[model samples]
Target: MSPTLVFGVIAAYFILLLVISYFTSRKADNNTFFTADKQSPWFLVAFGMVGATLSGVTFISVPGEVGNTNWTYLQFVMGNMVGYAVIALVLIPLFYRLKLVSIYEYLRDRFGQNSYLSGASFFLISQTIGASFRLFLAALVLQLAFFDAFGIPFYVTVLTNIALIWLYTFRGGIKTIVWTDTLQTTFLLLAVVVSIIMIINHLDLSVPQVFTVVTESDLSTIFEWDWRSGQNFFKTFLAGIFITIAMNGLDQNIMQKNLTISNTGDAQKNILWFSITFFIATVLFLSLGVLLYEYATTQGIALPGRSDELYPMLALNHFGAVAGIVFLLGIIAAAFSSADSALTALTTSFCVDILGLKRKEHKNQNRTRMLVHIGFTILMFFVIIIFSSLNDSSVVSAVFKVAGFTYGPLLGLFAFGLLSKRTVNDKFVPFVVILSPVISIILDYNSEAWLNGYKFGFEILIVNAAITCLGLFLLKGNGKNERLNEAENL
Candidate 1:
C-alpha cells in the first residue's frame, strides 16, 4: 500500500465524517450534544453501538488473539451478552427514570457529593485509558502503514488523529456521533467480511472447506476449564458480565449514547439488539483471525514478533491494494467511532459531573463545553503517547485490565447504592473507592500464591468492586439505611 493511498483513504473518511457532522449538528445546542435532543431512532443507535463497542481493540487485537487464546475470548463475550441484558433490564430504566445527563448523577442522589464525584472520576480514568488503548492500536498501524513512510513521528500522528475527532465532535457531540457511527459500523463489518473472504480465496478453500479448516484448526479452541488460567470459562465469563456492567452501564462513554434515545423502552430495545450485533461482529473477527494465520502459513510469511501486528501487516503489505484500502477504511472508522464519542463523553462528564455547568446557569454554557471538549481531546492525545511507551501486553487484554481496576469503584458504588440502602459517610466515599482498587491490586498480585493457586483475570473487577462495597458498608452513613434515592432527592 502506498503511503499516498493510505493518506487518501484517511482524508476521504474524515471528510465523510465532517459532512455527517455538518448535517447532524445543524441547530445543535447543549441538549443536542448531550442527548441528541432525545429523538434518536432506536435501531440506528443499536447498530452504531456495534462499532463503538468493538472499537480498534477488537478490530485488531481480538483477531490476533486467536493465535494464542483461540476462541476463549468468546467465553468472556458470552458473559458480555448477559451483562448487556443487565444493563438493559436494570440500569437503562434507572438512568432514564432519573432523566440523567451524566449517569454519575445517580450517585449524587443515591449517596452524596463524594460518591457521585468518585463514580465520575473513576469513569474518566477508566475510559481515558480504554479509549487510548483502542486508538493506540489504530495509530500504531497507521504509523507503520502511512506515517513512517514519510518519516513522521508517532506523537504527531496521535495528535493528528485526536484532532480529527475533535473537529467532528466539538459541536454536534452525540448527535453527530449517532449517525456517523452507523456509517463506521458498516465499514467495520465490511472490513471483516472482506478480509475473511479474501483469506479463504487465497487459501482456495470453499465455504465448507473454510469452515472445516477453522473448526479443525487447533487455534479455534474456544473454552478453557483450567481455573488457574486467566481465560478460564468461569473467570472470563464472570469478568465479562461485571466488566460490561461496569464499563457500559456505569461509564458515561457508552450510556451517553444510549441516553440519546427518546425513552427507556427505546433505549432498552436498542441494547437488546446491540448485544446480538456485537456478538456476531466479534465472531466474524475471530474467524478472520483463523483465516489470517492460515493465509500466512500457506504463503510462507513470517509472523510478526507480536500477534497484534499480524492483521495490519497482512492487510496493508501482503493482501494487495483492495484489502489494504479496506483495512485503512475499517481501522480509521474504528478509531474515530470510539475515540470521538469518548472525547464527547469525557467532556460531558467533566462539564456535568465536575464543573456543574449544566446544573447552574452560566453566561456561556456552549463556550464552557467547547473548552472542556478540547481539554479532553488534548488529554487523550497525551494518554495515547503514554500508552505507546508503556503498553507491553496484548491491547485487548490491556484494555480489559484497565477496566478491571478503574471501573471497579463505579461498579461497587452503584451496586451498593442500588442493592443496599446503607448510606456511607459521603465525604469518605472517595477514600473507600480509592482503597478498594489498591486492596484488589494487592490481592490480585498474590492471588495465585495466596489463594491456593487461584489466578485473577478480568474477574479482578469483581474483587475491586466488592472491596469498595465493603468499605462503604463499614462507613454506614449517618445511621440511615434506605433505598436508591428518589427524584425528590435530586
Candidate 2:
C-alpha cells in the first residue's frame, strides 16, 4: 500500500472522531467531561470497552505471540473471566454505593489523606506509563507504515499521534470516548474478521477446514502443564485474575467509564457483557494467529525476526493492498480507542484527585482542566519517546511487567482498606507502598537464580501485592479509633 493512501485513511478516521466529539462536548461541563454526567448508556459503555481493553498492543502482538508461545495466552484469557466477575460483583457495587467520581476516593474515605494520595499517585504513574507504552507501539507502526516512506523523523510521528488524540478528546473527554470507542471497536473487529477471511480464501479452505488445520497445528496447544515454566496454566490463570482486578477493577481508566453508568445494576451488566465479548474477541485474535502461522508455512514465507512484526509484515507485504488498507485502519482504530480514553482518565484523575477540583468552586475550573489535559498529553509524548528508545522485549510483556510493579502498591492499598479494618499509620503508608514494588523488582530479577530456577510470570503481581499488604499490617495502628484520629489530623 502507498503511504499517501494509508495517510488518507487515518485522516478520514480522525475526522469522524472529531465529529463525534463536537456533538458529545456540546453543553458539556466539568461533570460531563469527567463522568459524562453519569448518563452513559450501559450497552454503549460495554461495547466501547472492547476496543479500550484490546488496545494497539493486542491488535499487533497477540497474533505474533502465536508463533512463539502457541495458544497458551488463552490461559490468561480464561482467568480474565474470573477477574471480570469479581469486578462486576465486588468493585462496581462499592464504587456505586460510595458515589465516587474517582475510584481512589474510596481510599480517602477508608484511609487518611496520605493513603489517598498514595493510591492516586500510584494510579497516575501506572496509567501514564501504561498509556505511553501502548501509544509507543502504535506510533512505531505508524512510523513504519507512513512516516519512514516520507523520510519523516520518528519523534515527529509521535507528536502528531498525541496531538490528534488531544484534539478529539480535550473537550468531551469520557463522553466523547464512549461513542468514539464504539465506532472504533466496530472497525477493529471488522479488520480482524476481514483479515481472517482473506487468509482463508487465499488458502482456498472452508470454515471447517480452517478449524481442522488450526487444530492439527502445534500452535493450537492451549494448556501449559509444565509446573516450572513461566507460562504454566495455574500461574497465568491466577495472574490474569489478579491483573484484571488490579488493572481494570482498580484502574481509573477502566472504572472511570463504569462510574459513568447511572446505577449499580447497569454498571454490573456492562461488565458482564464486556467480559463475554472480550472472551469471544480474544479467541478470534488467537485463531487469526493460528491462521497467520499456517499461511506463512504453507506459502514458504520467511517470518520476521521479532514475533511482534509477523502480522504487520504479512498483512502489508504479502496479503495485497486491500488487506494492507484494512490493517492500517484496524491499528489506527485500536490505537486511538485506547489512547483517547487514557488521556481523558489521566486528566480526570489529576484534576479531581490531585487538584481537588470537585471540592473547589473556582470560576476557572474548565480552564484548569484543559491545561491539565495538555500537560498529560505532553507527558505521554515524552514517555512514548523514551519507551521507543528503550523497549527490547515483546510490547505485551513489557506492559504487564510494568503493571506488576506499579499497580502492586495500588492492589495492596485497596486490599488493606477493604479486606481489613485496621488503619495504618498515615505517614508510613507512602513508605510501605514504595517498598513493595522495589522488593518485587528484586525478587523478579533474581527469581531464577535465588529460587532454584523457579521462573515467575505475571503472577508476580500477586506476590508484589502480598508484600505491600504485609507491610501495611505491620504498620497498623493499635487503637480502635486510630482511623478516626488520623482523619481528624488531616
Q: Best lDDT goes to which candidate?
A: 2
TM for candidate 1 is 0.97
Clashes of 2: 0
Clashing pairs in 2: none
Query: lDDT tens digits, residues 38-148, model 2?
Result: 999999999999999999888989999888889999999999999999999888888887788898887877777888889999999999999998888778888888999
Query: What lDDT score belongs to each candidate, Candidate 1 first?
Result: 0.89, 0.89
Count clashes in each candidate, considering only residues at least 3 apart in sequence or on different chains.
1, 0
* lDDT at residue 272 of model 1 (Cα atoms): 93
Model 1 lDDT tens row, 1-490: 8888888999988899899999999988888888888899999999999999999988999899899899999999999999999999889988888899999998888888878888889888888888888999888988998999889999999988888889998888899999999999999999888888778778888999998988999999999999899989999999999999998888898999999998999999999999998998888898889989989998999999889999998998877789889998899889779988988899999999998877333449888999989888888888899889987878988888878888888899888888876678899888889999999888988988898999889999999999988898898767663535763332
Worst 10 residues of 2 by lDDT: 481-490
The alpha-carbon root-mean-square deviation between model 2 and the true structure, to one decimal in Å, is: 2.5
TM-score of predicted model 2? 0.97
